[model samples]
Target chain A: MAKRLQRASETVFAPEDPEFQIAPMVDVLLVILLFFVSITSAETIKARPQSLRVLELPVAKDSKKKETSAGEVVINAGWEDGSGMLEVAEVSTSKFADPDRMRQFLRDAVKADPSLRALIRADRKVEYGFINQIMLVCTQEGISNITFAVVDKERQG
Target chain B: MAGGGGGGGEEGDYGFQIAPMVDIMFVLILFFMTAAMMKVSENELGIKAAGTPTASQEAQPAEIQLRIDADGTVSFNDRVIGSPIDDSLAALRSRLKEAIDLFGEKQPVVIIPQSTVKHERVIEVLNACAAANVKNLTFGGGS
Candidate 1:
Protein backbone atom coordinates (compact mmCIF):
# COMPACT_ATOMS: atom_id res chain seq x y z
CA MET A 1 0.00 0.00 0.00
CA ALA A 2 2.79 2.45 0.93
CA LYS A 3 4.63 1.84 -2.41
CA ARG A 4 1.40 2.20 -4.42
CA LEU A 5 0.60 5.49 -2.68
CA GLN A 6 4.12 6.82 -3.38
CA ARG A 7 3.81 6.08 -7.13
CA ALA A 8 0.44 7.87 -7.32
CA SER A 9 1.76 11.04 -5.60
CA GLU A 10 4.82 11.15 -7.90
CA THR A 11 2.60 10.90 -11.01
CA VAL A 12 0.44 13.76 -9.80
CA PHE A 13 3.37 16.16 -9.04
CA ALA A 14 5.91 15.07 -11.63
CA PRO A 15 8.92 17.29 -12.61
CA GLU A 16 8.00 17.10 -16.33
CA ASP A 17 4.39 18.21 -16.08
CA PRO A 18 2.16 19.09 -19.11
CA GLU A 19 1.12 22.40 -17.57
CA PHE A 20 1.20 25.45 -19.86
CA GLN A 21 4.29 27.71 -19.58
CA ILE A 22 3.49 31.41 -19.90
CA ALA A 23 6.93 33.03 -19.55
CA PRO A 24 8.09 32.42 -23.13
CA MET A 25 4.76 33.34 -24.65
CA VAL A 26 4.50 36.47 -22.52
CA ASP A 27 7.93 37.63 -23.68
CA VAL A 28 6.96 37.27 -27.34
CA LEU A 29 3.70 39.14 -26.86
CA LEU A 30 5.54 41.97 -25.09
CA VAL A 31 7.96 42.38 -27.99
CA ILE A 32 5.15 42.55 -30.52
CA LEU A 33 3.27 45.06 -28.38
CA LEU A 34 6.31 47.35 -28.20
CA PHE A 35 6.83 47.25 -31.94
CA PHE A 36 3.22 48.23 -32.68
CA VAL A 37 3.23 50.95 -30.02
CA SER A 38 6.29 52.57 -31.58
CA ILE A 39 4.81 52.48 -35.05
CA THR A 40 1.54 54.09 -33.98
CA SER A 41 3.32 56.91 -32.13
CA ALA A 42 5.68 57.61 -35.03
CA GLU A 43 2.77 58.00 -37.43
CA THR A 44 0.92 60.59 -35.39
CA ILE A 45 3.05 63.46 -36.71
CA LYS A 46 1.76 63.11 -40.29
CA ALA A 47 -1.80 62.03 -39.51
CA ARG A 48 -4.50 64.67 -39.59
CA PRO A 49 -7.83 64.38 -37.89
CA GLN A 50 -10.42 62.39 -39.81
CA SER A 51 -13.01 65.16 -39.67
CA LEU A 52 -10.95 67.22 -42.16
CA ARG A 53 -11.29 66.02 -45.71
CA VAL A 54 -8.05 65.51 -47.59
CA LEU A 55 -7.41 67.86 -50.47
CA GLU A 56 -6.38 66.47 -53.83
CA LEU A 57 -2.89 67.95 -53.73
CA PRO A 58 -1.07 68.96 -56.88
CA VAL A 59 1.60 66.55 -58.01
CA ALA A 60 5.24 67.62 -58.28
CA LYS A 61 7.65 65.76 -60.51
CA ASP A 62 10.45 66.23 -58.06
CA SER A 63 10.22 63.08 -56.02
CA LYS A 64 13.09 64.20 -53.80
CA LYS A 65 11.28 67.28 -52.53
CA LYS A 66 11.60 67.92 -48.83
CA GLU A 67 8.66 67.51 -46.49
CA THR A 68 7.38 70.16 -44.12
CA SER A 69 8.89 69.91 -40.69
CA ALA A 70 6.85 69.36 -37.59
CA GLY A 71 5.54 72.33 -35.56
CA GLU A 72 4.96 74.46 -38.66
CA VAL A 73 1.44 75.80 -38.91
CA VAL A 74 -0.59 74.04 -41.62
CA ILE A 75 -3.52 75.90 -43.16
CA ASN A 76 -5.96 73.98 -45.36
CA ALA A 77 -7.44 75.71 -48.39
CA GLY A 78 -10.22 73.81 -50.10
CA TRP A 79 -13.61 74.36 -51.66
CA GLU A 80 -16.51 73.63 -49.35
CA ASP A 81 -18.77 71.29 -51.26
CA GLY A 82 -21.92 72.18 -49.35
CA SER A 83 -21.73 75.95 -49.63
CA GLY A 84 -19.58 76.15 -52.80
CA MET A 85 -17.34 78.64 -51.01
CA LEU A 86 -13.61 78.87 -50.52
CA GLU A 87 -12.59 77.86 -47.00
CA VAL A 88 -9.33 78.79 -45.40
CA ALA A 89 -8.76 76.88 -42.19
CA GLU A 90 -12.52 76.43 -41.87
CA VAL A 91 -13.31 80.17 -42.35
CA SER A 92 -15.46 80.85 -45.38
CA THR A 93 -14.33 83.88 -47.37
CA SER A 94 -15.22 85.39 -50.69
CA LYS A 95 -12.82 85.46 -53.63
CA PHE A 96 -12.25 89.14 -52.93
CA ALA A 97 -12.47 89.08 -49.13
CA ASP A 98 -10.12 91.28 -47.12
CA PRO A 99 -7.04 89.40 -45.88
CA ASP A 100 -6.46 91.51 -42.77
CA ARG A 101 -7.94 88.97 -40.38
CA MET A 102 -5.97 86.06 -41.78
CA ARG A 103 -2.83 88.14 -41.72
CA GLN A 104 -3.41 89.07 -38.10
CA PHE A 105 -3.92 85.45 -37.15
CA LEU A 106 -0.66 84.47 -38.77
CA ARG A 107 1.10 87.43 -37.21
CA ASP A 108 0.04 86.39 -33.74
CA ALA A 109 1.06 82.80 -34.40
CA VAL A 110 4.46 83.86 -35.69
CA LYS A 111 4.99 86.19 -32.76
CA ALA A 112 4.38 83.31 -30.39
CA ASP A 113 6.82 81.09 -32.28
CA PRO A 114 9.48 82.97 -34.21
CA SER A 115 10.72 79.91 -36.02
CA LEU A 116 7.28 79.04 -37.29
CA ARG A 117 6.73 78.33 -40.99
CA ALA A 118 3.44 78.31 -42.89
CA LEU A 119 2.35 75.39 -45.03
CA ILE A 120 -0.54 75.73 -47.44
CA ARG A 121 -2.45 72.57 -48.34
CA ALA A 122 -4.53 73.73 -51.25
CA ASP A 123 -6.62 71.50 -53.49
CA ARG A 124 -5.47 70.89 -57.05
CA LYS A 125 -8.81 72.11 -58.43
CA VAL A 126 -8.72 75.30 -56.39
CA GLU A 127 -8.29 78.58 -58.24
CA TYR A 128 -4.98 80.42 -58.13
CA GLY A 129 -6.62 83.43 -56.55
CA PHE A 130 -7.32 81.58 -53.32
CA ILE A 131 -3.75 80.39 -52.98
CA ASN A 132 -2.36 83.78 -53.93
CA GLN A 133 -4.50 85.38 -51.31
CA ILE A 134 -3.16 83.03 -48.64
CA MET A 135 0.39 83.69 -49.82
CA LEU A 136 -0.24 87.38 -49.60
CA VAL A 137 -1.46 86.98 -46.07
CA CYS A 138 1.63 85.01 -45.14
CA THR A 139 3.87 87.71 -46.54
CA GLN A 140 2.01 90.59 -44.90
CA GLU A 141 2.21 88.84 -41.57
CA GLY A 142 6.04 88.85 -41.82
CA ILE A 143 6.20 85.08 -42.18
CA SER A 144 8.90 84.45 -44.73
CA ASN A 145 9.09 80.68 -44.60
CA ILE A 146 6.27 79.36 -46.75
CA THR A 147 5.76 76.07 -48.56
CA PHE A 148 3.02 74.46 -50.65
CA ALA A 149 1.98 70.95 -49.82
CA VAL A 150 2.10 68.62 -52.84
CA VAL A 151 1.89 64.97 -53.68
CA ASP A 152 4.77 63.10 -55.25
CA LYS A 153 3.99 62.32 -58.86
CA GLU A 154 6.21 59.29 -59.16
CA ARG A 155 5.04 57.73 -55.90
CA GLN A 156 1.40 57.81 -56.92
CA GLY A 157 2.01 54.72 -59.00
CA MET B 1 -13.04 3.28 -5.66
CA ALA B 2 -14.41 4.86 -8.89
CA GLY B 3 -15.46 8.03 -7.04
CA GLY B 4 -11.98 8.44 -5.48
CA GLY B 5 -10.27 8.04 -8.87
CA GLY B 6 -12.55 10.66 -10.44
CA GLY B 7 -11.69 13.14 -7.64
CA GLY B 8 -7.93 12.59 -8.22
CA GLY B 9 -8.32 13.23 -12.03
CA GLU B 10 -10.16 16.49 -11.41
CA GLU B 11 -7.39 17.77 -9.12
CA GLY B 12 -4.69 17.16 -11.75
CA ASP B 13 -6.58 18.98 -14.52
CA TYR B 14 -6.02 22.49 -13.00
CA GLY B 15 -3.10 24.22 -14.80
CA PHE B 16 -2.05 27.64 -16.13
CA GLN B 17 -4.68 29.31 -18.39
CA ILE B 18 -3.53 30.65 -21.84
CA ALA B 19 -6.83 31.48 -23.59
CA PRO B 20 -7.23 34.88 -21.86
CA MET B 21 -3.67 35.89 -22.70
CA VAL B 22 -4.07 35.05 -26.39
CA ASP B 23 -7.34 37.01 -26.46
CA ILE B 24 -5.60 40.12 -25.12
CA MET B 25 -2.81 39.86 -27.69
CA PHE B 26 -5.27 39.52 -30.52
CA VAL B 27 -7.11 42.62 -29.32
CA LEU B 28 -3.88 44.62 -29.25
CA ILE B 29 -2.97 43.48 -32.74
CA LEU B 30 -6.33 44.65 -34.08
CA PHE B 31 -5.91 48.07 -32.52
CA PHE B 32 -2.47 48.66 -34.04
CA MET B 33 -3.51 47.45 -37.47
CA THR B 34 -6.30 50.00 -37.55
CA ALA B 35 -4.04 52.80 -36.37
CA ALA B 36 -1.39 52.13 -39.01
CA MET B 37 -3.96 52.24 -41.80
CA MET B 38 -5.05 55.75 -40.84
CA LYS B 39 -1.66 57.42 -41.37
CA VAL B 40 -0.93 59.29 -44.59
CA SER B 41 2.35 60.61 -45.99
CA GLU B 42 2.65 64.30 -46.87
CA ASN B 43 5.14 66.16 -49.13
CA GLU B 44 5.82 69.88 -49.68
CA LEU B 45 7.21 72.29 -52.29
CA GLY B 46 9.01 75.35 -51.00
CA ILE B 47 7.98 78.77 -52.38
CA LYS B 48 9.42 82.11 -51.34
CA ALA B 49 7.02 84.56 -49.79
CA ALA B 50 6.19 87.52 -52.05
CA GLY B 51 7.39 90.35 -49.84
CA THR B 52 10.82 88.87 -49.09
CA PRO B 53 13.89 89.95 -51.12
CA THR B 54 15.12 86.64 -52.49
CA ALA B 55 17.65 88.18 -54.88
CA SER B 56 19.20 91.59 -55.39
CA GLN B 57 18.44 93.46 -58.63
CA GLU B 58 22.12 93.89 -59.49
CA ALA B 59 22.73 90.16 -59.16
CA GLN B 60 19.76 89.36 -61.41
CA PRO B 61 20.96 89.56 -65.03
CA ALA B 62 17.46 89.81 -66.56
CA GLU B 63 13.80 89.05 -65.97
CA ILE B 64 11.49 86.51 -67.65
CA GLN B 65 7.77 87.06 -67.49
CA LEU B 66 5.31 84.13 -67.49
CA ARG B 67 1.57 84.47 -67.75
CA ILE B 68 -1.19 81.91 -67.32
CA ASP B 69 -4.66 82.67 -68.58
CA ALA B 70 -7.93 81.41 -67.12
CA ASP B 71 -8.04 78.69 -69.75
CA GLY B 72 -4.67 77.09 -68.78
CA THR B 73 -2.72 78.83 -71.59
CA VAL B 74 0.93 79.54 -70.70
CA SER B 75 2.96 82.44 -72.10
CA PHE B 76 6.63 83.26 -71.61
CA ASN B 77 8.05 86.77 -72.06
CA ASP B 78 4.70 87.80 -73.62
CA ARG B 79 4.94 85.02 -76.27
CA VAL B 80 2.54 82.15 -75.68
CA ILE B 81 4.20 78.75 -75.49
CA GLY B 82 2.53 75.48 -76.58
CA SER B 83 -0.76 74.29 -75.04
CA PRO B 84 -0.59 74.25 -71.21
CA ILE B 85 -0.27 70.51 -70.63
CA ASP B 86 2.39 67.84 -70.21
CA ASP B 87 3.21 67.53 -73.94
CA SER B 88 3.52 71.29 -74.37
CA LEU B 89 5.40 71.77 -71.10
CA ALA B 90 8.57 70.64 -72.84
CA ALA B 91 8.35 73.63 -75.16
CA LEU B 92 7.83 75.96 -72.23
CA ARG B 93 10.85 74.42 -70.52
CA SER B 94 13.09 75.03 -73.55
CA ARG B 95 11.94 78.63 -73.84
CA LEU B 96 12.67 79.16 -70.17
CA LYS B 97 16.11 77.59 -70.68
CA GLU B 98 16.84 79.98 -73.56
CA ALA B 99 16.01 82.91 -71.32
CA ILE B 100 18.18 81.43 -68.58
CA ASP B 101 21.14 81.23 -70.97
CA LEU B 102 20.79 84.84 -72.19
CA PHE B 103 19.97 86.42 -68.81
CA GLY B 104 22.24 84.21 -66.71
CA GLU B 105 21.06 81.57 -64.25
CA LYS B 106 20.21 84.17 -61.59
CA GLN B 107 17.42 85.68 -63.67
CA PRO B 108 14.13 86.03 -61.84
CA VAL B 109 11.08 84.51 -63.53
CA VAL B 110 7.87 86.25 -62.57
CA ILE B 111 4.64 84.28 -62.88
CA ILE B 112 1.32 86.06 -63.25
CA PRO B 113 -1.68 83.74 -63.06
CA GLN B 114 -5.19 85.02 -63.63
CA SER B 115 -7.54 84.55 -60.73
CA THR B 116 -9.70 82.12 -62.67
CA VAL B 117 -6.84 79.83 -63.67
CA LYS B 118 -6.56 76.49 -61.95
CA HIS B 119 -3.88 76.21 -59.31
CA GLU B 120 -2.68 72.97 -60.86
CA ARG B 121 -1.87 74.80 -64.06
CA VAL B 122 0.21 77.32 -62.16
CA ILE B 123 2.04 74.50 -60.46
CA GLU B 124 2.80 72.99 -63.83
CA VAL B 125 4.39 76.27 -64.86
CA LEU B 126 6.38 76.33 -61.64
CA ASN B 127 7.56 72.77 -62.29
CA ALA B 128 8.69 73.77 -65.76
CA CYS B 129 10.66 76.68 -64.37
CA ALA B 130 12.29 74.38 -61.86
CA ALA B 131 13.19 71.91 -64.60
CA ALA B 132 14.90 74.71 -66.54
CA ASN B 133 17.18 75.34 -63.54
CA VAL B 134 15.55 78.69 -62.81
CA LYS B 135 15.90 79.26 -59.08
CA ASN B 136 14.52 82.76 -58.58
CA LEU B 137 10.73 82.90 -58.89
CA THR B 138 8.32 85.70 -58.03
CA PHE B 139 4.52 85.96 -58.15
CA GLY B 140 3.15 89.08 -59.80
CA GLY B 141 -0.35 90.54 -60.40
CA GLY B 142 -1.26 90.60 -56.76
CA SER B 143 -4.41 88.94 -55.42
Candidate 2:
Protein backbone atom coordinates (compact mmCIF):
# COMPACT_ATOMS: atom_id res chain seq x y z
CA MET A 1 0.00 0.00 0.00
CA ALA A 2 2.82 2.50 0.79
CA LYS A 3 4.56 1.75 -2.54
CA ARG A 4 1.32 2.23 -4.52
CA LEU A 5 0.59 5.64 -2.87
CA GLN A 6 4.13 6.89 -3.56
CA ARG A 7 3.87 5.91 -7.26
CA ALA A 8 0.46 7.65 -7.55
CA SER A 9 1.82 10.89 -6.06
CA GLU A 10 4.74 10.94 -8.56
CA THR A 11 2.44 10.55 -11.57
CA VAL A 12 -0.51 12.73 -10.42
CA PHE A 13 0.78 16.32 -10.06
CA ALA A 14 -2.20 18.63 -9.28
CA PRO A 15 -0.81 21.74 -11.12
CA GLU A 16 0.80 19.99 -14.07
CA ASP A 17 -2.10 20.48 -16.56
CA PRO A 18 -2.23 23.97 -18.16
CA GLU A 19 -6.00 23.88 -18.94
CA PHE A 20 -6.91 22.42 -15.56
CA GLN A 21 -8.74 25.58 -14.38
CA ILE A 22 -9.55 27.55 -17.57
CA ALA A 23 -13.28 26.89 -17.46
CA PRO A 24 -13.70 27.54 -13.69
CA MET A 25 -11.58 30.73 -13.74
CA VAL A 26 -13.55 32.04 -16.69
CA ASP A 27 -16.83 31.28 -14.90
CA VAL A 28 -15.69 33.01 -11.69
CA LEU A 29 -14.38 36.05 -13.53
CA LEU A 30 -17.65 36.41 -15.39
CA VAL A 31 -19.63 36.14 -12.17
CA ILE A 32 -17.49 38.69 -10.33
CA LEU A 33 -17.73 41.08 -13.27
CA LEU A 34 -21.50 40.70 -13.34
CA PHE A 35 -21.73 41.34 -9.60
CA PHE A 36 -19.81 44.62 -9.79
CA VAL A 37 -21.77 45.84 -12.82
CA SER A 38 -25.12 45.21 -11.15
CA ILE A 39 -24.05 46.87 -7.90
CA THR A 40 -23.01 50.17 -9.57
CA SER A 41 -26.00 50.19 -11.92
CA ALA A 42 -28.42 49.88 -9.03
CA GLU A 43 -26.63 52.64 -7.06
CA THR A 44 -27.12 55.35 -9.71
CA ILE A 45 -30.87 54.70 -9.81
CA LYS A 46 -31.26 54.62 -6.04
CA ALA A 47 -32.96 57.72 -4.64
CA ARG A 48 -32.83 59.16 -1.12
CA PRO A 49 -34.55 61.87 0.90
CA GLN A 50 -32.70 65.19 0.48
CA SER A 51 -31.64 67.43 3.31
CA LEU A 52 -29.33 69.86 1.56
CA ARG A 53 -30.80 73.15 0.30
CA VAL A 54 -29.76 74.55 -3.10
CA LEU A 55 -29.53 78.25 -3.91
CA GLU A 56 -30.40 79.22 -7.44
CA LEU A 57 -27.48 79.80 -9.75
CA PRO A 58 -28.02 82.63 -12.22
CA VAL A 59 -28.34 81.61 -15.85
CA ALA A 60 -29.30 83.22 -19.15
CA LYS A 61 -32.97 82.59 -20.04
CA ASP A 62 -33.66 80.15 -22.80
CA SER A 63 -37.17 80.52 -24.25
CA LYS A 64 -37.33 76.93 -25.43
CA LYS A 65 -36.52 75.54 -21.97
CA LYS A 66 -39.00 77.83 -20.18
CA GLU A 67 -42.09 76.46 -21.93
CA THR A 68 -41.48 72.82 -21.03
CA SER A 69 -40.73 73.33 -17.33
CA ALA A 70 -43.29 74.41 -14.75
CA GLY A 71 -43.09 77.46 -12.51
CA GLU A 72 -41.44 77.61 -9.03
CA VAL A 73 -42.86 78.08 -5.52
CA VAL A 74 -40.60 80.35 -3.50
CA ILE A 75 -40.88 80.86 0.25
CA ASN A 76 -39.02 83.72 1.88
CA ALA A 77 -38.66 82.55 5.48
CA GLY A 78 -37.84 84.70 8.50
CA TRP A 79 -37.99 84.58 12.28
CA GLU A 80 -39.64 87.04 14.70
CA ASP A 81 -38.41 87.01 18.31
CA GLY A 82 -38.65 83.28 18.97
CA SER A 83 -41.47 82.62 16.49
CA GLY A 84 -41.05 81.81 12.82
CA MET A 85 -42.76 83.24 9.75
CA LEU A 86 -42.41 82.60 6.05
CA GLU A 87 -43.76 84.79 3.26
CA VAL A 88 -44.92 82.79 0.26
CA ALA A 89 -44.18 84.84 -2.81
CA GLU A 90 -44.60 84.53 -6.56
CA VAL A 91 -44.47 86.88 -9.51
CA SER A 92 -48.03 88.05 -8.77
CA THR A 93 -48.67 87.91 -5.01
CA SER A 94 -47.37 87.11 -1.52
CA LYS A 95 -49.24 85.60 1.43
CA PHE A 96 -48.24 85.23 5.06
CA ALA A 97 -49.35 83.35 8.24
CA ASP A 98 -50.54 79.77 8.92
CA PRO A 99 -48.24 76.94 7.96
CA ASP A 100 -51.11 74.66 6.98
CA ARG A 101 -52.40 77.26 4.56
CA MET A 102 -48.99 77.38 2.98
CA ARG A 103 -49.08 73.63 2.73
CA GLN A 104 -52.39 73.89 0.90
CA PHE A 105 -50.93 76.56 -1.33
CA LEU A 106 -48.06 74.25 -2.19
CA ARG A 107 -50.50 71.50 -3.02
CA ASP A 108 -52.43 73.85 -5.29
CA ALA A 109 -49.29 75.11 -6.98
CA VAL A 110 -48.11 71.58 -7.58
CA LYS A 111 -51.53 70.63 -8.92
CA ALA A 112 -51.48 73.55 -11.32
CA ASP A 113 -48.07 72.87 -12.79
CA PRO A 114 -47.35 69.27 -11.71
CA SER A 115 -43.73 69.80 -12.67
CA LEU A 116 -42.87 72.88 -10.62
CA ARG A 117 -40.20 72.57 -7.93
CA ALA A 118 -40.50 74.25 -4.53
CA LEU A 119 -37.71 76.73 -3.70
CA ILE A 120 -37.42 77.63 -0.03
CA ARG A 121 -35.49 80.84 0.75
CA ALA A 122 -35.24 80.81 4.50
CA ASP A 123 -33.40 83.17 6.83
CA ARG A 124 -30.50 81.67 8.73
CA LYS A 125 -32.27 82.09 12.08
CA VAL A 126 -35.43 80.18 11.22
CA GLU A 127 -36.06 77.13 13.39
CA TYR A 128 -35.79 73.46 12.50
CA GLY A 129 -39.41 72.55 13.27
CA PHE A 130 -40.65 74.78 10.44
CA ILE A 131 -38.21 73.14 8.07
CA ASN A 132 -39.66 69.78 8.97
CA GLN A 133 -43.12 71.05 8.04
CA ILE A 134 -41.86 72.17 4.63
CA MET A 135 -40.36 68.76 4.02
CA LEU A 136 -43.55 67.05 5.16
CA VAL A 137 -45.57 69.13 2.73
CA CYS A 138 -43.24 68.33 -0.16
CA THR A 139 -43.53 64.62 0.59
CA GLN A 140 -47.28 64.96 0.70
CA GLU A 141 -47.40 66.78 -2.61
CA GLY A 142 -45.12 64.19 -4.24
CA ILE A 143 -42.90 67.06 -5.38
CA SER A 144 -39.60 65.30 -5.68
CA ASN A 145 -37.44 68.14 -6.99
CA ILE A 146 -36.78 70.55 -4.11
CA THR A 147 -34.02 73.17 -4.16
CA PHE A 148 -32.81 75.43 -1.40
CA ALA A 149 -31.57 78.91 -2.25
CA VAL A 150 -28.19 79.14 -0.59
CA VAL A 151 -25.25 81.56 -0.64
CA ASP A 152 -22.39 79.86 -2.34
CA LYS A 153 -20.19 78.34 0.35
CA GLU A 154 -17.05 79.17 -1.53
CA ARG A 155 -18.15 82.70 -2.43
CA GLN A 156 -19.54 83.38 1.05
CA GLY A 157 -16.53 81.94 2.80
CA MET B 1 -8.51 10.14 -25.15
CA ALA B 2 -5.48 11.97 -26.55
CA GLY B 3 -2.05 10.43 -27.23
CA GLY B 4 -0.79 11.26 -23.69
CA GLY B 5 0.33 9.16 -20.68
CA GLY B 6 -3.02 9.59 -18.94
CA GLY B 7 -5.03 9.11 -22.17
CA GLY B 8 -5.80 5.55 -21.04
CA GLY B 9 -7.96 7.02 -18.23
CA GLU B 10 -11.73 6.69 -18.77
CA GLU B 11 -13.41 9.45 -20.78
CA GLY B 12 -16.05 9.81 -18.05
CA ASP B 13 -13.45 10.36 -15.26
CA TYR B 14 -12.71 14.06 -15.82
CA GLY B 15 -14.41 16.38 -13.31
CA PHE B 16 -13.71 19.79 -11.77
CA GLN B 17 -12.84 20.14 -8.11
CA ILE B 18 -15.25 22.11 -5.89
CA ALA B 19 -12.87 22.84 -2.99
CA PRO B 20 -11.54 26.12 -4.46
CA MET B 21 -15.07 27.28 -5.33
CA VAL B 22 -16.11 26.60 -1.78
CA ASP B 23 -13.19 28.69 -0.51
CA ILE B 24 -14.19 31.55 -2.77
CA MET B 25 -17.79 31.33 -1.61
CA PHE B 26 -16.63 31.43 2.01
CA VAL B 27 -14.64 34.59 1.28
CA LEU B 28 -17.70 36.23 -0.29
CA ILE B 29 -19.85 35.29 2.67
CA LEU B 30 -17.31 36.80 5.05
CA PHE B 31 -17.15 39.99 3.00
CA PHE B 32 -20.93 40.50 3.08
CA MET B 33 -21.15 39.70 6.77
CA THR B 34 -18.52 42.30 7.62
CA ALA B 35 -20.15 44.88 5.39
CA ALA B 36 -23.60 44.27 6.86
CA MET B 37 -22.26 44.83 10.35
CA MET B 38 -21.03 48.28 9.31
CA LYS B 39 -24.52 49.25 8.09
CA VAL B 40 -26.17 48.63 11.43
CA SER B 41 -24.74 51.85 12.89
CA GLU B 42 -26.50 54.15 10.42
CA ASN B 43 -30.06 55.48 10.65
CA GLU B 44 -32.34 53.61 8.26
CA LEU B 45 -34.51 56.68 7.65
CA GLY B 46 -31.50 58.55 6.32
CA ILE B 47 -31.24 55.94 3.62
CA LYS B 48 -34.83 55.98 2.30
CA ALA B 49 -35.93 58.32 -0.53
CA ALA B 50 -38.75 60.66 0.51
CA GLY B 51 -40.55 60.72 -2.83
CA THR B 52 -40.45 59.80 -6.51
CA PRO B 53 -37.81 61.03 -8.95
CA THR B 54 -37.46 64.68 -9.97
CA ALA B 55 -39.42 64.10 -13.21
CA SER B 56 -42.25 62.01 -11.74
CA GLN B 57 -45.73 63.33 -12.54
CA GLU B 58 -47.73 61.28 -10.06
CA ALA B 59 -50.74 63.09 -8.64
CA GLN B 60 -50.56 63.86 -4.93
CA PRO B 61 -53.04 65.21 -2.42
CA ALA B 62 -52.60 68.33 -0.30
CA GLU B 63 -49.46 67.81 1.74
CA ILE B 64 -47.97 69.70 4.68
CA GLN B 65 -44.42 70.96 4.17
CA LEU B 66 -43.04 71.30 7.70
CA ARG B 67 -39.84 73.33 7.83
CA ILE B 68 -37.69 73.26 10.91
CA ASP B 69 -34.94 75.85 10.74
CA ALA B 70 -31.72 75.97 12.69
CA ASP B 71 -33.34 77.67 15.69
CA GLY B 72 -36.07 75.04 16.05
CA THR B 73 -38.98 77.16 14.81
CA VAL B 74 -41.54 75.12 12.92
CA SER B 75 -43.57 75.94 9.85
CA PHE B 76 -46.19 74.11 7.87
CA ASN B 77 -46.04 74.54 4.15
CA ASP B 78 -44.54 78.02 4.04
CA ARG B 79 -46.46 79.53 6.97
CA VAL B 80 -44.64 79.89 10.23
CA ILE B 81 -46.31 78.51 13.32
CA GLY B 82 -46.68 80.37 16.61
CA SER B 83 -43.79 80.42 19.02
CA PRO B 84 -42.69 77.44 21.07
CA ILE B 85 -42.27 74.81 18.34
CA ASP B 86 -44.67 72.51 20.21
CA ASP B 87 -47.69 74.68 19.43
CA SER B 88 -46.89 74.58 15.77
CA LEU B 89 -46.38 70.84 16.05
CA ALA B 90 -49.78 70.33 17.70
CA ALA B 91 -51.41 72.51 15.09
CA LEU B 92 -49.60 70.54 12.44
CA ARG B 93 -51.02 67.28 13.81
CA SER B 94 -54.59 68.58 13.75
CA ARG B 95 -54.21 69.87 10.23
CA LEU B 96 -52.58 66.67 9.04
CA LYS B 97 -55.37 64.59 10.51
CA GLU B 98 -57.93 66.75 8.78
CA ALA B 99 -56.07 66.48 5.46
CA ILE B 100 -55.71 62.72 5.81
CA ASP B 101 -59.43 62.44 6.47
CA LEU B 102 -60.31 64.63 3.51
CA PHE B 103 -57.75 63.32 1.04
CA GLY B 104 -57.84 59.69 2.22
CA GLU B 105 -55.23 57.79 4.26
CA LYS B 106 -52.84 57.09 1.41
CA GLN B 107 -52.13 60.75 0.59
CA PRO B 108 -48.46 61.63 0.69
CA VAL B 109 -47.00 64.04 3.29
CA VAL B 110 -43.59 65.63 2.78
CA ILE B 111 -41.00 67.39 4.94
CA ILE B 112 -38.82 69.98 3.22
CA PRO B 113 -35.66 70.71 5.14
CA GLN B 114 -33.00 73.41 5.24
CA SER B 115 -29.34 72.68 5.72
CA THR B 116 -28.95 74.17 9.20
CA VAL B 117 -32.02 72.65 10.84
CA LYS B 118 -31.35 70.69 13.97
CA HIS B 119 -31.54 66.92 13.61
CA GLU B 120 -33.65 66.74 16.75
CA ARG B 121 -36.30 68.98 15.22
CA VAL B 122 -36.64 66.61 12.27
CA ILE B 123 -37.14 63.68 14.62
CA GLU B 124 -39.72 65.66 16.57
CA VAL B 125 -41.75 66.14 13.41
CA LEU B 126 -41.42 62.48 12.52
CA ASN B 127 -42.64 61.53 15.97
CA ALA B 128 -45.54 63.95 15.77
CA CYS B 129 -46.61 62.69 12.34
CA ALA B 130 -46.35 59.08 13.44
CA ALA B 131 -48.39 59.88 16.53
CA ALA B 132 -51.04 61.56 14.37
CA ASN B 133 -51.25 58.39 12.25
CA VAL B 134 -50.02 60.06 9.08
CA LYS B 135 -48.19 57.19 7.39
CA ASN B 136 -47.27 58.75 4.07
CA LEU B 137 -44.00 60.57 4.70
CA THR B 138 -41.32 62.18 2.54
CA PHE B 139 -38.47 64.67 2.82
CA GLY B 140 -36.92 67.12 0.38
CA GLY B 141 -34.30 69.85 0.56
CA GLY B 142 -35.76 73.26 1.20
CA SER B 143 -34.68 76.84 1.88
Best by lDDT: 1
Candidate 2, residues B21-45, lDDT tens digits: the string is 5556657645654544332111112
What tens-digit string does per-residue lDDT give for candidate 1 at B62-128? 6777888888887887788847555339898888888887876677788899987877787778778
Give i-RMS (Å) per prediction.
Answer: 4.5, 15.5
DockQ score of the complex predicted as candidate 2? 0.08
Alpha carbon lDDT of residue A45, candidate 2? Answer: 18
Q: Which ten residues in a row have the lowest lDDT in candidate 1 chain B?
A: B1-10
lDDT score for residue B65 of model 1 = 79
Residue-level lDDT tens digits of model 2 in A48-90: 1122222222211110112111366655555555665556643
Task: Give the best candidate by TM-score.
Answer: 1
Candidate number with greatest DockQ: 1
lDDT of 1 by residue, A41-94 (tens): 773254342344556777767523554366576676665552212334423333
Docking class of 1: acceptable
Superposed on all Cα atoms, the candidates' RMSDs to the truth, in angstroms, are 9.9, 15.8
